[model samples]
Target: MKRLIVLLQVFLIGACLNKELTNDQELQKPIIQSPWVENPDEIGHDFYPRPQMKRANWENLNGFWDYAILPKGEKLPTLFDGQIRVPFAVESDLSGVLRKVGENQELWYRRSLSLNSLQDGKRFLLHFGGVDWESEVFVNGKSIGVHRGGYDPFSFDITPFIISDEDQELCIRVWDPSDQGPQPRGKQVNIPNSIWYTPVTGIWQTVWLEEVPEFYISSLKNTPDFDKKTIEVLAIISSESVADKVVVKALDEGMLVAETAVTPGEKAELKIQNPKQWSPKDPFLYDIEISLMQGDQELDKVYSYAALRKISQEVDENGIQRMMLNGEFLFQYGPLDQGWWPDGLYTAPNEEAMLFDILKTKEMGFNMIRKHVKVEPAQWYYHCDRLGMLVWQDMPNGDHGNVWEHRLGIVGKATDKQRSQESEQIYLNEWKAIIDANYNFPSIVVWVPFNEAWGQFNTKEVTEWTIDYDKTRLVNSASGGNFIMDGSKITGHMIDLHSYPEAVMPDPNIFGKDNILVLGEFGGLGLPIAGHTWQNEDNWGYQSFTDKEDLANRYKQLIDKLEELIQKGLSAAVYTQTTDVEIEVNGLMTYDRKVIKLDRDWLRSLHQKLYDLEIQINQ
Candidate 1:
């Protein structure tokens, strides 16, 4: 791990903390058998990981793996020092390796497993839920896979590398420089402070294996048409011969809606009448069962679902552009979700923990969450769908060059067009992968290309391409800063003009001209709980408050000001954050998912009023 140049006193303190980490050491002591804390009997974690696409046979390799940190350009470590859990980033407490693999270091992981259990005429596939920047994997020291991008899932067919009856060794290597590299890394820095946190390196997400047929469905893409009340389905197969005879079976409420077989590359359409629309209030999801067969012989099968919905911007009665969901204007009240956990960092400690954040937000009266910069696990979106939450997904930023803009407050200007182009291509590729991965989920309605000019460039092209890639969702060209007035909404950052417990509604007339008015950011309420912060003393937010009551009082006042703006033209707003992350102590919940800083009832009241305004505007 890369060492930080800290004061001698602070370095000694960190060394003491490292020595005091006993529970994690105990957790890592078991070698042959991992000391996994599988709280299956616990609430929330038992739900299936993926809701949109369901498969019956799969195993989660999330417990423990041998890990070691090496110096720059060092060969793979010869011996493992200890163990760390898969899926959880090194910076997270749950990983059992609470250290930073900064720009100058490398992380290595190795594990051995028997594949004999997967020998029932089933093919073996290796899957990575997500990795920070770059990763390379080898099975039995034979290179099998390489993947890039920090937020998209990728897989490799390891059938050739594995002898089904033998114990195969899996090895992985990763490198991430966080903010130092000109990559789409968001808010990660070696020197953590303020908005930035410690860099996450190596396998930060789930590393698992699945058993499937030789020729199986690789992915499913769904497009919904609210006007016709129909959905279009396109299933991609691994091979071409099986593609020509692809058959789709659509199911709703456990009943078959329609059955049709089409050529692999063509759109297979299914129609429904007066479909139950999906929203924060009524998140109705129709089930779908699909099977591909050739002459009565089942080749492959999978289960998925979709919802009929539309999101757009339209002129309201007062001649101001308003965000319309399902053809009616609605005021969107949500939180700025950073998607981090104290224990799991990038991965949640348990699945329920993931759902808890969304459900708690909804209970607090929010209908949406601006998934800031980071893309979450598929299960995260599934929870949002079932619990009734809206999402604005941001493409993870990379390729350097946005640091100056952030400091100078000159957002949305491209410094070097060359780097911007490279970053844009990478962004598009990952965005398409994310869109394709979650295309079936109905909760996500908007795509945010850039945030506050963090690696932002070519907004018009990126926004246009997003619309072309997925016509069903709205695209906010940029959020929290800058305006080219090209996309669907005119978003503004309204907070901390003087104090942290602050809020502002941008002049509706700016977006009332053509774009819908939206407060992309607001309400950075901060309260650092004792024993619940990454760094106790130096913890900071936009503004700091001493007590919960004071924070709540100021929050209510901010909401009241926002309410007045909604009466004028504001259509949507996002609170500062869903949970506190690293040194930024400005979240409704603490970093460890322990407590809610504000009274639940008080938070819910604010949301109830926001939703009520939405209904009124639509009427």
Candidate 2:
């Protein structure tokens, strides 16, 4: 306890001390925020964040927070400038304060929240859905914890630091060096331009506090066994003393569906009669009410949900390897979601804005989206499941690799081969961390090992390593370029031909081996809406258009081109992106997410056609 107090003190002070920032030149233009929409408190995220495991009483720490950005080498500000909604980056307009916290500065956030109904004797835990790069947390000036990874969720038990009062001051100091730092900072850079976007520093995810009982449920691991028609459930109980027995019950609308008894560290399989399968088209969720009992006495209880689905790779009728969703081949098509907003660099303006992207993608007749090189808040995946959208998740890339080594690929020029090895190890660790963090989402059907060879090294080993790590999902060994065919042929090496704008199917007769043909990325059509662009001079797209109508027509033509490719053997194709990022004006919508560049009806018509085409090929 004495050591813990000293450590907390050091952590609290450290958050204030760290200042690896850069010289800040004022941003050319400022971002804008959207008006707040009234939402229900009860069903706020009424849906479960984690499809695999969930809790009922868990509190969501999203709402407004007081923020201040002090220059590097400066002391903490005496007073905060204004309030900014958390889970959103400082540069994001939705955060209420659009400002830049360069590589050499520390961004500070302080919020005083009062807990209302934290039942007596319950242990309170503070949870941060995610924080960029490095973060240190403090409750009432007493340090609670510190975390390194920016994408994964971390929680600290604040029961010890609690002052026995309802009101508590939560302060967090964040430092993110974007691309300049060795951390897994994805495509973010200080100088925003084509392909790279504005830096997202500090808390870019939900920051909430939850009250749990002493010896409460920590994590729920749900694995679906398709062959056996069983769902393996493991409930990890957080306890001071060893748990003797635990009980789990699955229910739908108060009716008993399944129940099981188990010992700590043991998995319990719950079986049902003719379970309703879960898919993008039909996302059936089973409500679960888990109760941890000590000999018929309920000590702790929480509610959650899960879907029964499976993803795999298999040979199709045409003798081509295809992605199988629940034992059926389905051609996945959707936007390349970078998960950035004009207002919220890492966070969305609201939950509605998050849903709008996925819903619009589905509405436009695309069944899947490739979330490019960045992990999103759990709610993003939850929205995908609810709205019937397939997801291909990309592990965030870290460390600079050889640019010369990737000259032949779409990843642009990287750093160098020899230097990339050191980056390779860092990439592997961060990828593993990302995988472990997001492995629970049912929407994520495929894992992209390397994107166009950005910081890519030991391609064959990395591909095989990813496969070995999690064989449950399909693996895109390498998206485009560096066609050293290895790992699973799901991502048909960009061999047959390179540099094609439209969807290109893989050649099945390639050396007598079948591969899943997918256009990992293509169609970077640029349409910079007059006032919606990040920069006027540097803004550029793959194929620039003069007006919205021309942009829409060109987009439709590219997608129409997909219809022909779908017939040949294209399993999946990802449009360049969903919304404009920085100067890259290829998003289906404007950077603010206010303008749908394409006609809604026309997009939906295209979606129907694509879905019908995909189902027919499988049949």
Best by TM-score: 1
What are the models' TM-scores?
A: 0.87, 0.85
Evaluated with lDDT, which candidate comes out highest?
1
The parts of candidate 2 lying over 4 Å away from their true place are 1-60, 63-83, 113-121, 165-168, 240-242, 252-254, 404-426, 484-500, 511-514, 535-538, 614-619
Q: Which 10 consecutive positions of candidate 2 have the poorest summed lDDT? A: 35-44
Counted clashes in each candidate structure: 8, 20
Give me the runs in candidate 1 sitting further than 4 Å from their true place.
1-49, 72-78, 117-121, 399-424, 485-501, 614-619
After aligning candidate 1 to the native by TM-score, how far in Å is the CA of 616 from where it should be? 7.8
Error of 2 at 8 (Å): 48
lDDT, residue 513, candidate 1? 52
Write the residue-wise lDDT of candidate 1 on 1-619 in tens digits. 2345457668888755753442123222211111123443331133455666667767666667899877667766679878977767877666777777666677888998676655554687788878888888888888777787888888988888886567999888887877767777777766556787656777776677777887788788888898888888888787765434667766777777777787766777888755788877788887776677777887788888888888876776777767888988778888899887655656666765777788888878888998988888888887787777899887777664543332111233434234555556777778788778777778999888777656666656666777787888877766753454344543322211112345555456544656665677776877898877776588877778989888888888888887887788777878888988877889998877677898888788766786676433434
